[model samples]
Target: MRPLIVFSDLTLDGYMTGPGDDLGFMVDDPALEAESTGELRNVADAIVVGRKVFPEMSAYWTSAEGDLAHWMNTAPKHLLTTDPSVDTSAWGNTVLEVGDGIERVRELKAKQGGALVVFGGTATVRSLIAADLVDQYWLKINPVLTGAGGSPFTALAGQRRLTLESARAYSSGTVLLVYTS
Candidate 1:
């Protein structure tokens, strides 16, 4: 089965984004961007995201032409959402799975493909982790500290353990931590 991977950036305090979706506290280092984006492309044959992330990310990346853009546009995408009203016809190679996120993801992983990369969607990530469906995690630890913000693991019902797979430091002081369950 293809591995389910979670890629996210968090502050020193483990907040994914500041309160009210304030993303100003997030740092963007060139080196980190290149490395993270490259890794994301390499590992995943398709990206599985929440409905909320699909419109924003698809609009931006599908129109921009680059390695990441090319990968995103051509690669298959699965959006997990319960809303049947969402129209995804404009997005090429995109599928809408309106059911339990974890079960839908598991079905996707069973298909023949590379890893399924998941970005944002903390709720979905937490569900996958709790179900032991995620195989890898790529967390970019930012330097700033957010007193209040979205957490990396919020909806998780219980404690879970992971093994460190690799770590890298960026020029801007952001650290990329890779883990496996």
Candidate 2:
């Protein structure tokens, strides 16, 4: 079974983005970037994302004409969405899973492959966490504070315990915290 991982950058106030989906408040540390890129490479065969996040992310990563962009553009991706009519031609090796998001994720995790990474869907992350399907969490704690904005983590019915597997500080003042549940 592959491990399910959730990755996110959060502000001091616990927000993932500022007003109108402004993510500029998140600090970018060079060392952190290097560490994240290295970790991302370990992710195997597939990337999972929610419907709402797919189009934008797919467009950005696929259209980017650089080394990193080329690599991500070619990776296999699975999108869980209520809307089944999404055109995936732009995203190579992309598939749409039309069913309960959590169930779909479970099915994916059961498959023989590398780590399955969930990038930016807050709702999907909450669902995965509640279902106890996520094995690892890579959270980048940014230095700035966004007074009010989007939250990376949604409210849960109960508390979920996690152990800090590793922690590293970057020269750019960003910290990467890896946790296992």
Candidate 3:
């Protein structure tokens, strides 16, 4: 099975976003998005995201230009959702994945693909982490502290240990913390 990498931006307090999915806490650096997500594009051929945030991500990337945009639009997106009313055909290259998410991800990992990168909707991230399915975690930790917000590792079913792979700090006061299970 190919490696599964999960990337997320977190505050010093371990919050992924402010209340209501607000990401206004992070410092604005266009290069950050390109530099960070750009790397994922190089190693990953497909993206798995939750249905909740799929539309928002798709809309933002559809009108984007450049390498990141190309990768985001071209990579086949698999949306995990139980909603039967969702029309996957509305998107260019999307598939609705129902049933066991962990099982589905395992099946995808078994395929002959490069890597499967997961984008978020809080619940999905937490679920994957809880299931111990994530192979690698790429967390960009900002210097700021958000007293209250959304976290990607909330309510984990069991404790999972990780080994520190690397840690690098960027000029934006953001530190990239890489960990592997």
Candidate 4:
């Protein structure tokens, strides 16, 4: 089975976004991004995202330029959404999967592929984590601290012990922590 990985950017306080979904707290270190994203794109051939994240992610990446956007535009996307209203025409090479998100991801993992990577789906990632389907977590912890906000780790049921695979400190004060459960 192909490995499934969750990719998320979190603050030192473990928040994904600040108030009003303000992402200004996120520090954009080009060098850090190139190093981290480049490595993942090399091995990941597909991207998985939840319905809620698909619209925003699709809109941004579709018109954006850069190696990451290029890869995102070309890579096969598996959108797990039961909402029939979602239109998948904006992005090419996308498969609109309707049904249980977890089950669909499980099915995708069973198929022949490189690695399935999840980008910006908090709830989706939480479900996968709860199901114990996520193989690894690629978390980028920024230096800034958001006093309060939304966290993917919020309300997570049970306990998940992760083994630290590697730790890398970037010049931008951002740290890349890789963990496998």
The numbered model that scores best in lDDT is: 4
**Tens digits of per-residue lDDT for model 2, 1-181:** 8998888887777776777778788775656765576667777557888887788888788766644465577778899987888898888899999889988988998889889888866667777877888899898888887688877556566787899999988876778899998
- 1-181 in candidate 4: lDDT tens per residue? 9999888888999887787666678788788777776988877899998888788888889998887888999999999999766789999888988999989999999999899999866778778777888899998999999898767776568787999999998888999999988
RMSD of each: 1.8, 1.8, 1.9, 1.4
Quality of model 3 by C-alpha lDDT: 0.82
The clash count of every prediction, one per candidate, is 0, 0, 0, 0
lDDT of 3 at 114: 88
- As a whole number from 0 to 100, the lDDT of residue 82 in candidate 4 is 92
RMSD of 4: 1.4
lDDT values, one for every candidate: 0.81, 0.80, 0.82, 0.86
Root mean square deviation (Cα) for candidate 3: 1.9
Model 4: lDDT equals: 0.86
Q: 52-138, model 1: which lDDT tens digit per residue?
A: 667777777767865666777888888899997888876788888988887898899899988998886566666777788889988
What TM-score does candidate 3 reach?
0.89
Worst 10 residues of 3 by lDDT: 28-37
Candidate ranking (lDDT, best to worst): 4, 3, 1, 2
